[model samples]
Target chain A: MSYRIEELLITTLAPMLEGLEHVAVGAASPIPGAAALLARHRGGGRPRVSMLASRRHASFTDGARELFDCAAQGRIDAFFLGGGQIDGSANINLVGIDGYPASRVRFPGSFGSAFMYFVVPRVILFSLEHSRRVMVPRVDFVSAPGTSPSNVYRPGGPYALVTSRCVFRFDRDRGRFALASVHPGQTLEDIREQTGFDFDVPARIEQTPAPGAQDLVLIRGPVGKDISETYPDFARRVLELDAATA
Target chain B: MTNLETLVEAIHDGASVALAPDYSGCAMAAVRALVRRGARDLRLIAVPQAGFQADMLIGAGCVGSVEAAAITLGEYGFAPRFTDAVKNGRITLRDSTCPAIHAGLQAAEKGVPFMPLRGILGSDLLTHRDDWKVIENPFSPDDAIVALPAIRPDVALFHAASADRHGNVWIGVRRELMLMAHAAHRTLVTVETVVDDDLLADEARAAGTIPALYVSAIAEVREGAWPIGLAGRYPADAAHLAEYARLARTAAGFERYLDEHVRGRASAA
Candidate 1:
C-alpha cells in the first residue's frame, strides 16, 4: 500500500513497543507519541502510553516531576529521545555545538535524556532529520552516553535509533549501532553518505516494511485523533486530519 | 487583595526566582510586569524546562543567568531569546537535567543539604555543574550516585486558576507548584479570580490547594496565564504564541513585541 513517510515511521516504531508495560513520550514528539498510541491500540491497550503536556492523555497526576520519578522506579519501560546531534556510538547531544557556556549553536538543553536514557530500559532515539549535521561524527557535548561502564548501576541504555532514512539497532554491549533496515526508496549508500558516524551493515539489507491496511486505518483514524489533541499542527499537516472535523 | 503591580514589586532586582514549566502554571502576567519594571540581574530557575516567560525575561535583559533542563516553545519551536542569549554569552547558562532540578528542589523542601539521584554520572552536565557531587553509596559498597545541592529560591512565582479570601490557591493537578512553594523562601501568586468561597473548605479542593501559610502574596489577574494557558481552565493561545515565535526571531522584533504587548499596554484579554 502506498503510504506517507509518517505512516511508514509509525508502523516502523509500533512493533518496538509490543509487550512493553508502559511507554512514555516527551514534549514535542508527535511521531513516537502516535506510534506508542498505535502500539497500544494494536496490543489491546496492554501498554499504557503517557504523552506529556496533553490533558486528555497524560496518566500523571503528581505533575512534571512524576515522569522522572516514575522512570527512576522502573515504571516506564520505554521512552523516545531526540537530539541536535547523534553519533554512531549513540551519544546524543541536545545541548549545543562547540564547548559548554560558549557554545556557538545552542539546541534545547537536555530535557530528561541525561536521566531517562539511563533508567528507561528501552530508549528509542528518534530524529526525522537524518543528515551529516544531525547524525554527527561525534556529538559536541554528550547529553547522555549510549552505554555506561559495566560497574555503573544502569538498567537502561540506547535500544534503537529511528530516522527518516533507516533504522539502526544499538548494541549496548558493543557500544555501536548496526544497520537494521532502510526505509522504502532509501539505499545503504544513501544512509552511509548522509550519516556522519559509521555503523555495521547486514549481509542482506532489508527495506523497512510499509504500513499495512490495518495499520493505516488505525493511524489515519484513532491514532491521528489521539495525537492531534497534543500535536495539532503535526496531525493536520502530516496525518492530514483536521481535528475539528475528524 | 494586593494589586498586580504590588505583587511584581515584591520581586526585587537580582532575586533568584523559580518558575513552573509552560505546561504547568506560569505567571505570565507577573513576567510581563517584571519586564515593564525592568527588573535586573534575576536568576531564573526552570523546574525542568521553560518557555515564553524565560525568553521574554532574557530578551528584556532582566535575567543574569538561567538554570534549566531545557527551554523551548514546545510546538511553537525554540525559545528565540533564550537561544540568542546563550549563543551570544549574554547570560550564564547552567545546563541541568529534569530529575536533578526536581531533586534539588526536593532537598530544599525536606530541609536537607542534598538529595541523591541515579544517572548523570557520565554526562557532561556533571562537568559544568560544580554544585552537584558524586559520592559512593555508604550503605552499598562501590555504588556511586549523584548528589544535588538543595535549590532554595528567593521566590516561587506562578498563576493559578483560583484563590480563596484566605490566600489558599487552587492549582488542580499541577502539584509542582507545591514543591516550588515548599522550596522557596517566599511564594507570590496571581489567580484568575478570588473566589468568595473558601477553597480549603471542600476536601476535594483542599487536596489540590496550596495553603495560605506558604503563600506570601496573592493578586487576582484574569487570564493571568494568557497565551500560555492554565491546564483544564483554558487552551493556549496558539496563534499568539506562533506570532511571538515568529517576531522574537530577531532582537528588534522582540523589542517591538514588548512595546506593543508588555509596556504601557492593556492586557491581551
Candidate 2:
C-alpha cells in the first residue's frame, strides 16, 4: 500500500522532534505544523508546539516579539525553514534569484528564518518540491547559512534536509549532506537526477519509514481536526476531512 | 489637525519610518493617506515582517528602502510589488531577522549604542550587514554574539482599536507598537475611535496603553485597518486581498489597482 507523501514527511519529522522541549512552526507551513502536532500527540505532549499563526497553538501574548525572544533564550528546540533555493552547504535563499538587488525570480523576503536558524538547535530544512531548481548547486543568495566558523559560538544548525523525494542528514563538520533514506516511491537515481547539488551516498540506503497503522489513525482522527484549525485546506485535502465532516 | 492628510504630511520624504508587522494593528487608512500625499523615499521598517501594506506602498513608489525580516502575503504568497521592486533593484533592501530588528529598536528605546543578540553566528545576514558586529563577550570570552546598532526612526505609525481623549492608545498585547513609539522621534496613530472616557483610570487597560506623551498625533478613522483588518475589531477582507494578488501581477494591472483602490479612494478623501 502506498502512503501519501505528506504522511511520510510527518513521520520523518516526528522523530527529529523527539525529546525536544518545544517546536515552532511558522506561518504557511502545513506539513511541519501537522508533524509537530503529531509529535505532541504521540509523545503525550512532551514537546510543546507553537504555531505562529494559530491562536490555540501559540502561548505567547507579545506575538513575534515573544517568539523571537523565546528563540533567543534557547527555549525553542526545533524549527522548520524553506527557501526559494537551497544549496549543498545548506545555504538557503528566501530572497530573489540571480543577485541581491536584481533577480529574475523573487520569493517572499526572509522572515525570522536567519534568526531562528541560528538560535534553534535542530533546524529542519524542508521543501515539498525537491527538483533541481529548488535544491540548487548554490543558492543565489544566502538567507541563512548552514555552517559557521568554529569560533562563532553557534549551538544550532541544519540537522537534516527533508524533501518529498528523500531525506538527507546535514554534516556540519564536512559541510555536506549525506543521503539517509530514499522515500518509498523513489530510487537513489531519482534523487541524484533531480538534485542540483552533490551529496555523499552510503553503500546501503534505507527506505524512508512509512506511518504506522496506529499513527495513521491518530493522523486521520484528532490530529487531523487539531491541524484544521490552523491549516484548513491542508487537512481537507491531505487527510480527506471535509468541512461538514471535520 | 485631525485630518488624515494633515497627519501624513508630518512625515517627510527620505524619513526613516517604522510600521507594525502584519499580525499587529496595521494602519492601512494612514498608509493610503500617505500614498495619496506622495510620500517618497521612506525607510519603512517592519517590526519583523509585513504583508500587503508593505507591498502596496512599494508598488505606489512611496518607499525607497524596506528593512524587515520578510515581506509576504502569508498564504496568498509572495508580495508581488515588493518582489518586483527587489528583482529590479529599485529599492534598498535591508535584509534582517526578527530578533535583530526587535533588539535594535529596543536599543533605540533605551538610548543605547548597541544591543547584543543571541544568534546570527552562522547566518549570511551577519556578513551582509555593516552595522552588525560580532564581539567576544567580555563576560565570557568563550561566547561570541552579534551586536546590532540602534534603529531609531524618524516616525512610528500604526492603527489602533481605540484611543482616549488623552491620546493614550490601547494596543492590548501588541506591545511592539509601544517599542516603535518609544524608539521614534514622532509617533502618528490612526484609531478606529477616540473615546472620551479616560483609559488610564482602569489599571488593567492602562497596562496595554501607549501613553499620550509618546504619541504626537492621533486621527480618529473608523475601520482604519481596512483590507488588512484591526485585531478583535474586524477581519481582513480576504476576497479583496485575493483580487489584489491576482491583478497586481502586471505593472499595468498594479497601476489599475492603484487607480481603482488606492489613488481613486485617496482622491475621494
Evaluated with lDDT, which candidate comes out highest?
1
User: Largest DockQ belongs to which candidate?
Assistant: 1
Off by over 4 Å in 2: A243-246, B142-144, B267-269
Give me the displacement of residue A213 in model 2, in angstroms: 2.8
Q: Candidate 1 residues A1-246, lDDT tens each? A: 678998899999999999999999988888999999999999999699998957677899887899999999999999999999999899999999987786888887998999999999999999999999999989999999888888788999999999999999999889999999999899998999999999999999999998899899889899899899988888899989998966
Interface RMSD of each: 0.8, 1.8
Best by TM-score: 1
Global lDDT of each model? 0.92, 0.87
**Model 1 residue B149 CA deviation in Å:** 0.2
Contacts from the true interface found in each model, as a fraction, amount to 0.84, 0.80
Query: Model 2, B120-177: lDDT tens per residue?
Result: 6666677778889988899877788788999999999999989998889999888889
How far does residue B190 in candidate 2 sit from its true spot (Å)? 1.3
